[model samples]
Target chain A: MATGVTATAGTTRGRSRLRAALRVTAAVFGAYAFAWGIAAFGSALGALAGLAPAEAVTAASLLALLVLPVAALWAFAVPRAVMGWVLLGGGGALMTGVACAVRMALP
Target chain B: MSRVGGPNRGTPRKGKLISPALRAAMLWPHTWAGVTLGGLLMLVFFMGSLAVFAQEIDRWMMPATRVEAAGVPISLDHLSLDRAVRPVVERLAAGRAVRDWYVQLPEPRRPVMALRVRTDQGNAGGMATVDGTLLPPVGTLGASSFFYPLHYSLHLRAGFVGYWIVSFASVAMLVGLISGVIIHARIFKDFFTFRSWGQVRRSLLDLHNLTGVLVLPFHLMITVTGIVIILPIVLPAGVQTLYGGDIDRFYTDALGGYERPRTGIPAPLAPLDPMVAEARRLWGGGEPAVIFVHNAGDAASYVRINRDTGDRISLDVEPVYFDGVTGALLQHRRPGPMVATHRVLSGLHFAAFEHWPLRWLYFLFGLSGCVLIGTGMLHWMEKRRVAHGVRPGVGWRTVAAATCGTTTGLLIATLAMMLANRLLPAAVPSRELVEVAVFFLSWIGAGLHAGVRTVGNPPWSGQCTAVAGLAAACVLLNWITTGEHPVRALAGGDWAILGVDGVLALTALASWRVARRLAHRPMRMVAPTNAEVSDHA
Candidate 1:
């Protein structure tokens, strides 16, 4: 009985460690995706707001870069890493998708 | 682990972690990451600091690139662009299917007429006088070509590899900066405290903290901006998605690509003087720094005048266009507000518009960043030695040697490259390549020397002695080869050349003093091997 309990504990520990590793990996991808997606969306939004292509590109790109470090630090230090992915990664992808669609629709 | 004479300096008397356990976890990562990549950071910082003076170095390196009599700012007052450059255009047009020709109008900083011809075959170029008398090649790549790029690309093979390595180091730097702030408990206290004459370990830590904090804002800005500048290369996903892998197309769309299509029909080239005069009028007394003629000797040929941006913090690249034949004003694209903001950020990073005093301040801050990284490296080794109970392994020892070589070896390599430029035969085929070869070899040699000598304490004094010798050699080499010795330069009022030699002599003196001081300092106790333990007794 004791041996079986010990085996179960070991398995649980191993599984938890793997989950932690996966979460961290997700966080990495999320942080970068969020950073890139914001720049894309920002540029499109600027273009939509009647800015010149050059102006839009420059303004959006710089603003996005400023946000990147903050996003990176926050991703690593979040209470639950999954929440960071939901808020930043998912939101970023959605924003970029909408922006791309809007850009395509415009002249 | 007592405070007065603790065996391990890092060991706390109370041994309490800073408030939150999660925040405390950041400390270890910060220290280890900085240690692991500190050498690369040191190289970046050290090379970058020198690159601030790249233009001055260029002037020193090419002693023959004369502009005018001393104290007189050279201008293209007497020269007409069409009359003076007709022969150059005619000669170049004789070649097969030329695409573009770049004619750099003389500026006060670099008062020489330079032209580069881009043909269907490839690019070919030479320096020239206002009358198109071809000047001989300098045979040395100036700091603009070498150290400035080395600061960013590390002279690695041309590919994504160099970009990746630099970007990775930059990321490491970011982490180091962030974590360093947290781990440095009592940050304000560290800002005020520098225990230089105290225990060696304490002094090392204090110096590291002091320099790191002194230039914290600069360090942060340089790192963040560096990553952003190389963003497309590092993070290509956004660009790839938007432009379908066409970088040029993306730039065209974003930068308002103003390229005129080539008309194959040939025609006589028009005079550039009128166009330049018109451009100056448009710029309101500012001269055009560079003039570009697209589709040279063709009906479609157009002149683009890039405005001088020395006074403005922004690098104003928006050129005013003119019809080459009619000299009619074509297109002038004014930058928008966002574009203006982008210019400010990039301008701040490059500091091209900054004057001498600001440039000197940037140089000092950059050097402090180098010192900060160097101290961090030493502290890491010291910390490791105190924590571990055995002699440092081969890997650790190799790093120690590299730490010595990179700091001093880099200086020697740079000086050697310059010396080789003066000493090497200028007529030798690919003379530029030969000089570069000498530079790499000297750098590698320094790394090897450090690897061997840094067995216990790093041989700081010995490397400083080498530095002093090499620096002295630099001054001597310039005097022997250029015939414009520091003394002669001073007599002639050629401060540019004299400044380089003066700085070299001062550096040599500084190194000698450092060697003397380092030689007398007590060596730190390494994890005692049999030899070290016996020596200790």
Candidate 2:
């Protein structure tokens, strides 16, 4: 019985590995798009106010919260979409970088 | 030991079975190793996690101690070496029992001239004004700061015993983590798959394995770094052998050179302002946090400025020692690569340089590490239950009960301590004792509840309830004691206290939901009759 279970589990693993690869690729692409969107929005906010670079970046973080709902909706509508995972990962990274850069450059 | 090809070797009983000898050999070590040290590990991890925010917690707990005045650069012109040295030296000489004297100048957000006078009888240190007026001792119970010291050096036996115990636990944790990872080969596949409804035993095993795998990196890093943080203590024999047993020389070479000793004869000292100015200039404009003046009135009276820029984890600043009379730069200790690396590692482990975002990340990772350990313990219990063929024996049950009690119970106990800090009278003698009382009492309560309730229902639900209840108590206690509503505190820009309260509230809500789910879980009845077991087999 244990041997049969092991054999079945091995086959399932091989199938899942392929699926996981596809999922990862989608996650990465979605992350990039989300990060790019955030960076662009932050730059726009920096231009709008005469605030220091850091302040502008902080303001941009506030704006990024709005995209959370969109991300949530995306997660709901397409539960396993590679795009949603990517967006979350990429957006977080982008915002962190922008915030750090602004902090160093501004004051 | 049983021989190969023995009847018991290949036998498949109703439930998993091993010979008495095999069971004793395998189960005894596993059980004893876990049971003896599990409570200690939970304490270390939990306290260390809280210690990550020691400074912020200090700030929140002792609001009255908050330094309102910003530090001003000490002017070189106004510095009178004779003036500063005469007062401190005279005081020390009069006491005649003084071992060491440390003078600390003002810093931003904690502007107070501090002096530490070390005597044969422990050490006495407190804040003072620039003009040398000693302030009343601050009485607020610093929960975060208290936990910080307690974590690495369990507030017992002058920190030596604590260090050894913590070091041993760290090594054990590392072993457990590696062994656990190896045993569960399908680690990644089970990530994020927590099925709460299934065979109760199988579901628990799955949940434990999944959570452990997900947070394995955090557990590994924390365990390894915790050992590294105390590496000097654990590996002192090696250092002793290599450095010819000159611990002082080893420290100086490994860390930085200790300031040259002073001539006992009185002499003028250099003003601190120039030293502070030079430090700021070198560090590119950050506030000099601590000013250490050595050899107070002698020719060797040198001032070293430690800048607190809050930029990097490495607190290394150029040390400028001067001739007391001439104010000439004597020696500057710029750390080499090894020393700088050590400082950086210490800073990272302590989270001293973290801001809000990074601190939150540490908190999340710490919580995940806790969950990882917890799940691993639970999984071990489930596996034992399945293998034992009967309900686990008294010893196994005790360990299972303790695992639930200590991990989740300590969290609640910490919350209870925080609440005690506020409700207990500020003027209460031995306030620390009061805090400890609350901590232990809450822990004992959880332990008793776990021991009693575990027989009827799954232990996880009771553990969850304990955590939720404690967390809720913390939030409510804060409101009750401080009279600072969460919204009002947030509005007032007192986010440190507010954030802690809010996070505790969220933790309670989440745990409560988990508890509710676990409470409804159906109980399993294992067959007591040997005939029934044979039939199943």
Candidate 3:
């Protein structure tokens, strides 16, 4: 009985540590990637809407900075660490792809 | 203190906006981030506070610049920019073909105009009085050049690695602040509560919360604007996407900057006073702070004059460009709304406006940020001391040492550098580098000492005493070398030097008192109560 309890506790500790590390990684890199995507996509959309290229970039960069910290904190707030990775990382990739397509489509 | 009516009593988690689970999750990041990056934040805050008075410190360090122009307005109209400044620019070129040149007009704080020339050989610069008489090299980077850069850049300019690191820490700081606000949802209830005479742990926590809550707005604004100033470089996705990775082009478009390439055909440069007058008229009355003549002696040369931004809370200088040969106005572009907003944010962070009261408030609030971070770390160690028992572990000791090294050790290093500046001979090769070496070497020594002594306890008392000694020594050395004591400085109307001396004296007194208290106070290891234990958990 003692051995079983010890094994369970050790497993729980290990699993929790891994989850914590994942959350940190997702918070830092995932949030940054998401911010970058927002900047790129927002800039492209603004330019398409008739704003000057520089103005679009400046406004989009400001928006990205405002979103970055909230996204970083959200990674920690979520129930499952994997959810953070999927939402931030996957969504960032999708937005960036669309932004690139828009850039290529521009005259 | 009725549980029914009191805020945060009994149902601590009830009616709170932030859920318990979310708060718990945030706690981890806040604690770890503050712990890991708190030292760097301390350096940034302390150096930034000092940088508020960077020009004054420059006057203190380089005594040659303490010119008597306190109330005398710099009348550039009467002073010939061509005769007074052009000769200095040409002299700085040293017979080498001048590529470009710029002159920073003297203000009240800095009475000596600064001029720099880029030549085929290299870049050379010098300081000259408003009347055009060149002064000897001060042979020191001083505060404006060294401390200000250290605050933002950490002196690591290669590929802007320092900017990236500072930005990362700033983001972490933002995270910590948001989490702290959530954790202390009832902060408003204890807005004015400060029980400094109570238990050390409780008092430290109170001070931390007090400063954190009170100075939150300033901290938030300062940190955000600091990041905004370098946003394009640190987060360049938009720039890369829109401008094809050319940051300069984005800046040119966003900031309304104008430039032209050299034609390689030589032409005699036109006089500069008219250009300055024209720029003033274009702006409807503003001082010409900086005049840059690009592609000097070329047919395509153009002069850019930036208006002084001291009177406004916007970093935008409204640069006016003119043909260098004809002195005719060429370009005067204005920024769009978004760009204008960016300039205002940058201005708030730069605090270059001529408002002494606001500048001092900025300095005080910046120091409060240092206090906030320092007290947070101290609170953590105090709470952990009981858990670690009589003999603390390596991890605990490491934090204690780092706290000491960053707080008092940083002060020691700064004071040591100031002392070295005064002591080093004028003719010593690389005198500035020698002072910088003194700063780093002393800081390392203090850090090593903390590491060794922290086995039993942090070497705070010793380091504090050393800080007091070094600060006092710097003041004394300044008086001895420059013969400009605080009293003499006052009589001479050199308020800049007087202010530096006054701050140094206060630092000495404050450190001495703190050291005495630390020496007398016994480290009591109180048994951890249920509340304390659970707080850490």
Which candidate has the highest DockQ of all?
3
Per-residue lDDT tens digits for candidate 3, residues B301-375, read: 999999999999999999999999999999999898888999999999999999999999999999999999999
Candidate 3's residue-wise lDDT over A1-107, tens digit each?
01112334666656666777777888899999899999999999988888989889989999999999989988887767788889998887888888889999887
On lDDT, the leading prediction is 3
User: Considering chain A alone, what is the TM-score of candidate 2?
Assistant: 0.42
Residue B277, candidate 1: C-alpha displacement in angstroms? 1.4
TM-score of each: 0.86, 0.67, 0.95
Predicted complexes: DockQ each: 0.19, 0.01, 0.39
Runs in model 3 lying further than 4 Å from the true structure: A1-8, B1-16
lDDT per residue as tens, model 2, B340-374: 65566556666656376887777777766666566
TM-score comparison, 1 vs 2, better candidate: 1
lDDT of each: 0.71, 0.57, 0.87
DockQ of 2: 0.01
Task: Please state what fraction of the native interface contacts candidate 2 reproduces.
Answer: 0.00
Clashing pairs in 3: none
Return whichever of 1 and 3 wins on TM-score: 3
